[model samples]
Target: MRNWTISGTLTVEPAEQRTDLLAEPVAKALAALESPDAGVVEIDPELADTGAFCEAYSSPMSASANCVVVAGKRAGEVRYAAALVLATTRADVNGVIKRRLDVRKASFAPMDEAVELTGMAYGGITPVGLPADWPILIDKAVADSPELVIGSGIRGGKLLVTGELLASLPGAEVIEDLAKPVA
Candidate 1:
């Protein structure tokens, strides 16, 4: 199942066969999928950030997705969730995400806290291996795309997957207008 739609200077291979490039949780999550038609490609850890990776590999930024961790608090309880949006857009954390988490305030989770909780490297937190209870809000644009380039839970590689695949994750919720186009 190594058929992939995204391309660059990287060699795409079956993710199952390149588990070494994935975070433990991400590898486990993909392994558990009934039809994990995902592909993996190794890269320089320094170029893992969306912009750098896209420019360096000659990949369109629109074909990439970003998974951001958000934190909110209500009644003294902290709630966490992941937001998936196109690289060319920004997640509506203050609007859609805050309401979805039912919190008075929502903000990007701090790097230390996010990495510690997710057990994934900073800048490489994909929605696939999040805590079971954490909702993964995927923007409709991302869900509707045919294919996407997303983090592999580590800075050294990326995963190629379809919108349908991400929408089918354990706690995924595809929502319209979950993100705003960058101006």
Candidate 2:
């Protein structure tokens, strides 16, 4: 099994060593957590989207995860959560996620709001540096993976982490069926 990787033009480095490519919040979060299994790989910014990144870097779709920010309103107060699901599945936004947030309705956060709040590019909002109060609802499959490739909070790179490392993040909650397989 490849614990470290070098694919195409991307060079993987210990996550702690690639602060230059990490967003400020991500850097701070990683520093606070000090997860040793975390790694990072720099890539062309243009290939930041999941399908493109996997194809260009020779990464399997099964090992890629996507983070989506969602918002819900209850009693006129907005609640937000970050959901992590495998690339092959989609978050159960209207069902499981809404129930978890205790809101009558739930939906993807607006692109502009997600980008502004997360301080990351539209396609690169990662769970790593999410606001401290927002829950990180990670699908069980993602938390069970031996290794996962996820956004690095910037389009220029990706973060490589073990399932345990992801689950250990400050508000991460491993939820069963948090996502349903894509039809």
- TM-score of every model? 0.98, 0.95
Residue-level error in angstroms, candidate 2, position 47: 0.6
lDDT of 2 by residue, 1-183 (tens): 246542445677877887987888888898988546778888889999999998988888898999999999999999999999999999999999999999999999999999998988778789998999999999999999988889889999889887888899888999999999999
What candidate 1 gets wrong by more than 4 Å, as runs, is none
Q: For candidate 1, what is the TM-score? A: 0.98
lDDT at 105, model 2: 95
Candidate 2: residue pairs that collide: none
lDDT of 1 by residue, 1-183 (tens): 755657677789989999999999999999899978799999999999999999899778999999999999999999999999999999999999999999999999999999999989998999988999999999999999888999999999999999999999999999999999898
Model 2 alpha-carbon drift over 4 Å, by segment? 5-9
Clashing pairs in 1: none
